[model samples]
Target: MAYRKFRGTKLFTGKSWAPEDSVLITLPGGQVEAIVPASEAGEDIQAIEGILSPGFINAHCHLELSHMKSQIPPHTGMVPFLLRVMTNRQAAIETIQESIYLADQQMQKEGIVAVADICNTLHSLETKKSSPLQYHSFVEVSGFIGNTAQNRFDQGRAAWEKFREFGPASIVPHAPYSVSPELFRLINEFDPGCLLSMHNQESKAENDFFLTGQSALRDLYTAIGVNIGFFQPPQTTSLQAVLPYMNPANKLILVHNVLTSMDDLVCLEKHPVADTYFCVCPGANQYINQSMPPRFLLDDQVEKIVIGTDSLASNYQLSITEELKLLADFYPEIPMSHLLQWATMNGAMALNMDKKLGSFEKGKTPGVIALNNWQVTRLL
Candidate 1:
């Protein structure tokens, strides 16, 4: 393999940033070979600008919806915004294929090494098969009509099979408001150990729906003409209601915890909470929900905090650097080191890809990424 050495003013090898004179050596195939202090490098070294770090792990994304960028209006509350996505997500086959192709290229340019992408269909499977980036597909299963739960579960399984050929894949529920309790149980029974991801407490209406059965979601269900006959109000927060259906020790990823509360955290902490992760999509949250997640309050509950772009439908850019900048802008007290951890290593651990990606460990092929201001470029 061809050998290449990159010199950077600073290097963040997942744990901490190295000072000026850091050299990262890699094979042309991308596996890290060795690292050395800058003084030891030849004067003709290929120097990299800005912070040299491992490629960003977009813990969540929806590359399939790249065709819908700007199609939905911004700052609409979660319920209505979801409805808009449901109604507007349609295009010619070639249009979708082209958009997915472009989106994949954009992410590569932004230095996304791995993704935990949400999929409702296998439309983007072809793009994934040929792409160099790693993917862990989350086949999103959504159905509230109790009678159709089995059918929806089966369909999700079929989608999972198709998606698995490209990479690691699992059937995951979309959100508590959209997935019936029976469907959640069906998923838990299918594979308790598989990584399960759900949209958690993105809106007050989601909590209100489970706690009192009175939320805008009720009106949405009525307007959509779906009878939730098998559903029963849990009279608790949405997170608490679904806890019983999940295996406590199983890995779970909760996205957009804008409404997650201290009580909900306490309840989860009392159970097996070791493997749980909370992912924040700050841009998407601000764009679609008109709010920012109370991330500071959730610092103590989760083992790791990861970042995501959500989707093009809700975010303008797919860069984790932009997400970290927004987080730092909102909570200026948080250290850049911690934010870098969230964007890199924490995301890798969350997706269970840490063994191969995340940091510049000797023998690990963690892809190289360069960060400048709020943009990222994949150097390897």
Candidate 2:
């Protein structure tokens, strides 16, 4: 049951493209055997029209909130958004299940092969078990200030351990904003081998609260019965502040660094041991704050960046294509090929699944998607 041959006008071989080319893929399990000039295939070549590339990997998403598309009140700050989320928990959970079902279908149809999704609970366990796509679920935990830092770490570790029974891809985290410095220190001390994911400087208010200890967030914390009077003003950039508490050997996918300044990027560059990756959620940023992360921060660091749709609760749709399209529209000077890699290869790397899922390489089984009016003859 070998595929024998597939000739497309455009063939993306993960890292580069083959123009007017053909790939002789050995199937039974789809793996690229050889990518050669179209004329080299003789008469056995099967010409495939349109584009062909590796399946996409959405590096960061909250599938549990998939059901809340356009329903959560917009333009609210993060605190208000959280309150709204709490209020709508019951309805949101029901919608989350439905959204996950439809979103999974949409991912397949759009040629996505893997995801790095945030899980607040076990709600997504059954869905992941049933889906063909690869998943790395980060069990998210957050606490402002209460018990001992060791207690907080224990709570997070306990929750993660419970979910670990379901699969191989479970990880733990102290949610940003709410995670105490002491708890973060414990996380660093434990030094888990898995990658770290956190919402970093997603809002100006976050920066204000963390850096200066003054902002609208202070009011929100007070309202929520979490006093901020005893808290010390943050001494370092968010990335630096968290570095001591994270496994330096492990890569980090910093989500929504909308307000991350040049100093932060410099600090990241200084940490040679840190594999720092950025996950931009354009739609989610716009929904919550009427803005998106500054694309310029990614400049020469495009290779270190990936894309995510966030979730329907904070986005219009769960489509990586749309995310890339928005990126292209905003940063038209950037090459389309590079943008494609951000949505695919970079994403796979962020999820630590590049070895098996991201690219259309020798042994990878990433699905091929054809764009409308895409030229297959160009490949041949």
Candidate 3:
């Protein structure tokens, strides 16, 4: 392969940073030939930058809801916001498409390369077919608990088969809080050989219902005609509740872990067999609960945490860079490099694309992101 060099004042070479560096990245058949100091590369530099790093990867997003940017009210509780979302669902589709287009442009400008996007059906298929970014489309299914679980599972299976022809990465699931244990078991049987993504403990009400069989969610369930008596409150934590149905061989990417407690983290540590990951959507958390995930629970599990911009409907925008800035503000002690990995490499791993798209390692096709005039250094 012919080699190209990138000279930069600072280069983030996947795991670490090098000041005044040059990356000899081979092209055609993409691979890293060598990563040497800037003074070492002879003369074939293709680009020069003040700061360079691997392209960002968004772990969770609802691109179809991109059109709801600023349309949803700020700081609304999850239940009320979801009700509003359902009511305005039809009007949001066209705008969502437009949002996807604009979001693509914005992501590229801000240096994103791949995304784990959640889609309800065919809404994002067309947009994804044309976008330059890489995406893992999680076909979203939702229905009130009951016989509806099987029906939704069937619908999910049908959608998965239909869209399977569209791309290499596609999966299906019932949205959390909406999926029954039986349906979740059905999903676990698939063995997709990739990380499972789901909206885990995004709201306190969800945790409350699952833990104690009582919360605001009960009201919502009753209103929707879901038989409360037949529903046995989950005997375990939300993480444990979903564990039986998750593919044991594959990693699980838990999105919006807003209510995860210390005990939950301890359980995760004990069950080391489950390659669990956390994708924190701070903006979306702030929107729904006026709070963010408990960073303190992360502990020594920094490598297992990733970043995601949930959806424009519940976020300011689909920008991972902005998420990093927020992380910096909220948890300043967490190294910036680690934060970048959460937005980039860790996210890629969540979608099972790490081998080809996470870092600037040998054989990865992920692009490089240039950050100009940003002085934050040493991200590990």
Candidate 4:
């Protein structure tokens, strides 16, 4: 906690990272004490090579499924993927514990200061309690069985309460296809002001199921012994159908969005929620649906776009930088500056941790991360 100056070869202040000149920030006790130009820097400054910036924020992730890394095959689409996950989600407790620990450590190493993790059970609470990274647990509420709405709500609430002692946690829906109208209403009654993050239109099949009632999901549900005959097609996009049920007061996060079309963006207007945001896990999109969210679908959406790695189950690793790198490799026009904001400030804002963990502003304890040729390195 002693005084030190972390002078970098180049520094990205969460806005710009250019001019290729020296930048210096003096810190004592993990707080930024001063920011001075290279000309004003004293000889005591500790110079280092690389791009220094605030740490990354994984806006959406599933740390509980850490043990399922590569457990299910990729590009199977949502129906097959969900079937595989449902069938194979359970593993030995020790294995699940070890994987979660390692994944948390990897996120810390990759400069992730905060994460918005999806939780379906309390299995990951111990890991979150001991991890260096800050976590906001989204206790996922998922049940399509209309008659079992109360039970599902109670289960989700119990999970949220279990995680609440560890950190900020709230009950949220799992996905559009998984939650019924009754269950969604129950979630609203539980707490309409809390933040909600859920899978949106990850694939066309989801839209197909809700829009036309003809989708693989129908068969999959029957195969799993879940009665869908009582469920009727909305004849509209999934998001549109769920919009009316959502409380405008709550902060909504729509994840994946691989199949979100230009038409789907129009449906967003019906969303009364003013604090809604979008999270794109580019790697997971490609892994599960064989296509990433198109650059056009994301061009105007930049203001709301935040990055997440989804889970190791559908991803090779949990590094937010790698997610950005994949996008950069594909879309060369998306300025690195924009990608950095999506990784840091935007994500922190989405998770409501902007005041402490986003930009390297005065008095903010935003952790320092060095991007050495686009590879994430924790400097603080």
Clashes of each: 1, 5, 1, 0
Give the per-residue lDDT of model 1 (tens digit) for 143-197.
8866678999999999999999889999998998888778887888888688988
Candidate ranking (TM-score, best to worst): 4, 1, 2, 3
Model 2 vs. true fold: TM: 0.89
User: lDDT of all the models against the reference?
Assistant: 0.85, 0.71, 0.72, 0.84
The true-structure Cα RMSD of candidate 3 reads: 3.4
Return the TM-score for candidate 1, rounded to 2 decimals: 0.95
In the range 167-200, model 3's lDDT, one tens digit per residue, is: 6444545445677766766666765555567788
| Model 4: pairs clashing at backbone N, Cα or C within 3 Å | none
| lDDT of the structure predicted as candidate 1 | 0.85
Q: Give the Å error, residue 213, model 4.
A: 1.3
Q: After superposition, how far is residue 264 of candidate 1 from its true place, in Å?
A: 1.5
What's the lDDT for residue 139 in model 2? 74
- Pick by TM-score: 3 or 4, better one: 4
